[model samples]
Target: MKMTDLILKYLSIKTEVKIPGFGIFQQKNVPAFYDERLAALLPPAKEFFFTEDFNLKDENFIQFVAKEKNIDINESYAEIAELVNYWKFTLQNKIVLEIPDLGTFYFNDEGNFIFKGKHFSTESPENFGLEELNLSELKNRKSALGKSLENEYKTSRNPFWWLLLIIPVTAIIYLGTQNPELIFGKKSFKNLKKTKTDSVVKSRNLLKDSTKIDSTKSKIPTPKLK
Candidate 1:
């Protein structure tokens, strides 16, 4: 039997058509949008919406469809990937893709690629008796919270930065004190040693002069001996 015939046979409520890894198809009733202005322009939107639950692991089903249609599955997959990538890169670029049995997929003015038959409002809010949502305050609050989180992250990383800075500075100070000539270049160490020797000699001379004054005071005669 043809693939479509097989699919149709298994699509009954009791059979619960399962596309391998994809989820089961279950019928659901969707509510219609009640708008007087839209009702005047077009027929009342359909009350039901048919949506598919995609399966990432449905490669076999995809291959079966490709074989049944006499198409190269790999080439088709690549083409689809390219189309999706292009759409993502050029968000403003609009294109229409029509699958054989499925409906057309086209980008609308709002940059959304909605299914052709989906219900959407084209009229202004006044026509629908609706008011614009006041989301400015909520948006501002979220923005403030984001800023607070950014500041907190900066503060948390501050200590690691201080450690990175201090370690290099400490290492330089240690190396400079240990080998002054390495930093100042040639003869700096010799000059430092000579300065220390001169200071020591000057201190010894001052001590000797104080001792001579004490000896002279001891040598003076008493009054009775004179």
Candidate 2:
């Protein structure tokens, strides 16, 4: 079996697979994710993390490989050692090591191993047939709600025009209640009644004068016609 296949085999039944003088591979379960900018929901997934561990020893890995290849323990150990050394040497020389169907492994500036694997998928089998949702309409609704709230806030802060009208009227009511004579003088109703009566009499006199003028004009016969 290939070195990558052995690593996958170890990871299948065990939580962690460590290759002596190389790195450790482990499966980690990740929770569901929400991308606000994309307005998408991503399902839970399984991801692999690789950590360089040079001092790890796995007797079970050796036994499994020896049994699988039908080789003795010594021969299996030697073969495993050769492959691990090759990978380590290549990584030290700053060359990328790619495992087929697994991932590419490289060393960063911090000398830490970074793995980019093809086997890592965000789609979960448990979430089969599920697709990402587009929340564009919900975003529009939220924007409209924000604008409406802003308008309400502005309206609340601004003074009402009717409030200005109420001030003078309120003052009039208060003054009239305190001292009646201030707003309406003595005999206020009588004076108002007299004013209205005077206005009516004046209108009647004007009407009577217009009638007399018309009668006078009619009594004056037109100069005798030739």
Candidate 3:
């Protein structure tokens, strides 16, 4: 049978059986036999319990099975090894594996493996299970919050900024009102008007001087006209 089929068959078993070095397959409430004499002889036997050691290296057995069944193992060995590694890590702290209807595999904290019946469920709580949160929703919420915060910051600074702007304007107005000449003095627009008026006055004076000169020449009359 295919390894998958074998696993399925093993899973279907209701009783717990040991897969030798791998682990033990069993159901709950099975008879627990104790050897008092043996326990007494070996003090350490008191804590001794049956456990499996299912490691990635155990894929060799699967390969053997594949060869025996004349099935193409091909890349499946590595695949199976990877799968076992995933299970080992994922079920690190768990003591038992509950394969529905197949059986349960148990592993001690120290990495010893054991198998048991499938009737029991060793699933973790809902909260403990893997969670799938919407990262997009979180990103969008953060973006919106960021925009709102930016707007709030601008709004908070607006009053101070306006005050800063108004201060300069007010100072200018005050200075203009206190000393209009300082802004519109002779050096500014009024200076140009005054310059034009001075030019016109000078031209008029020149004209008057020229007219006086002409009258003096006329009064001098040509002395040669006997």
Best-fitting candidate, scored by lDDT: 2
Candidate ranking under TM-score, highest first, comes to 2, 3, 1
Best model per TM-score: 2
Off by over 4 Å in 2: 33-42, 109-112, 117-226
| lDDT, candidate 2, 40-62, per-residue tens | 66566666778777888877777
Going through the candidates in order, what is the number of backbone clashes in each?
Answer: 0, 0, 13
Of the pair 2 and 3, which is ahead by TM-score?
Answer: 2
Q: By TM-score, is 1 or 2 better?
A: 2
List per-prediction Cα lDDT, in the order shown. 0.51, 0.77, 0.53
Off by over 4 Å in 1: 1-28, 40-57, 92-226
lDDT of 1: 0.51
| TM-scores for every predicted model | 0.24, 0.49, 0.27
